[model samples]
Target: MKLQQLMSQTRRAIDDYGMIHTGDKIAIGISGGKDSLTLLYALHGLQRFYPEKFDLEAITVDLGNPDFDLSHIRHLCETMQIPYTVVKTEIAQIVFEERKEKNPCSLCAKMRKGALNDAVKKLGCNKIAYAHHKDDIVETMMMSLIYEGHFYSFPPITHLDRTNLTVIRPLMYVSEADVKGFCRKYQLPVVKSPCPADGYTKRQYVKDLLRKLNLENPGVKERMFSAIINGNISDWTPRIR
Candidate 1:
C-alpha cells in the first residue's frame, strides 16, 4: 500500500476507536520492523493535519543482541525529525543464555515491554502506540483458543491502572499484506530480527494454520475478526464517534 492509502486506513482506525486525543503524547514502540516502521510513518503523517494535536516519540527496546542493528532506524528517525530513544538491556542474554528458556518469546516479550514502558514513562508519554495489525489480532485470538481454550484477543485500546498509561493499536484495521506492501513500496529501512526463535513459536504455527484455513475457507479470517469486534470481549468494541 502507498503512504496515502496507509494514512487513510490509519486515520479511520484512530477515529473509529477514539485512539487519539488533544495534547496527547504517544510513544511509538519501534522494533525496527515493518509493522512498527509503517506505524511510525502513519502517525507522523497524521500529526500534520489531525484536528487533535498530539506529539510523537519513537522508542525501541534493544534486546542486547549484537547482531541487532539500529543505525538505519536511527537515521530514519533523524530524517523524519521524530525524537527517538533506544533502551539498551541484557534481555537477550538473560532470556536465551542465562535463563536457557526453551520457550523464550513470553519472557522476552515481558522484559522488552517492561523496559519500554519504563522508558516511555520517563519520556512523559501518556500513551503508547503498538503496531499490531489485523492479522495479529486474529492470530492472537486463534492462539488463545487453541492454547488456552478461550476466545480472546487484545483490544484496540487498553488502559493500565497500575502504570496509568494507555496502549493503543492504530493499525488494527490494516492487513499484514498491506503492511508488507507499504514497507516495500516505501523501501522502509526494515531490520531483521536477530532472535533465534523468530519463526519457531506457537504463534508462528497458528499463523501458518490460519493461512491454510483462510486458503481453504475464504473469508474465514474476516469472519473471525468480525466476531472479535462484536463478541463484546473486554473493550474490543469500537468506540462510537
Candidate 2:
C-alpha cells in the first residue's frame, strides 16, 4: 500500500471514530513489528495535513529481552522527526523466569500496557494509538466467542477513566495484508520480536484458524469483519459526525 492509501484509510477511521481533536498529543505505541511501524508512518503522514494539528511521540516498552533492539526504530523516529522513548522493564524475566506461568500473554500484556500508560502520562500525552487493524478486530471477536462465549472486540475509541486517557485505533480500517505490502514497498526497517512465545500464543492460533477458514470459505474474513461493524455491540458503531 502506498502512503497516500494508508493515510486515506487512517483518516476515515479517525474521522468516523472521533479520535483526534485540535492540539491533541498522541503517543504511538511501537512494538517493533510491521503493524506498529506501519501505524507510525501513517500517523506521521497524517500529521502533515490533518485538521486537528496533533503532536506525536513514539514509545515502546522494552521487555528486558537480551536480543531486543531499538536502534533502527530510534533512527526511524529521528528521520521522521518524531520523538521516541523506550520504557525499560523486566516483564519478560518476571513472566518467564519469576512467575513461570503457563499462560503469560495476558499477564505480560497487562504489565506492558501499565508501563506504556505510565510513560504516556508522564510524557503528557492525552491519547495513545495502538496498531490494531481490521484483521485484529475480527480475530479478537472470534477469540472472545471461542474462549469466553460472547461477541466482543476492540473498539475504535475507548476512554480510560482510571488513567484519564483516551485510546484510539486509527489503523482500524487498514488490513494486515496492506500493512505488509506497505512495509515491503517502503523497505521499513522492521524489527523482529525476541519474545519466546511469539507465535505460540492463543492469538496466533486464532489468526491461523481465521486464515484456514478464509481459505475454505473465501470472503469469510470480510463477512466476519462486516459482522463486527454491524453487530451493534456497545461503542462499536462509529460516532455520528
TM-score of 1: 0.98
Clashes by residue pair, model 1: none
- TM-score, one value per model: 0.98, 0.98
- The best candidate by lDDT is 1
Tens digits of per-residue lDDT for model 1 on 34-136? Answer: 9999999999999999999999999999999998889999999999899999999999999999999998998999999999999999999999999999999
> Residue by residue across 47-142, what tens digits does model 2's lDDT show?
998989999999999999988879999999999999999999999999999999799999999999999999999999999999999999999999
CA lDDT for candidate 1: 0.94
User: What is the lDDT, from 0 to 100, of the residue 84 in candidate 1?
Assistant: 98
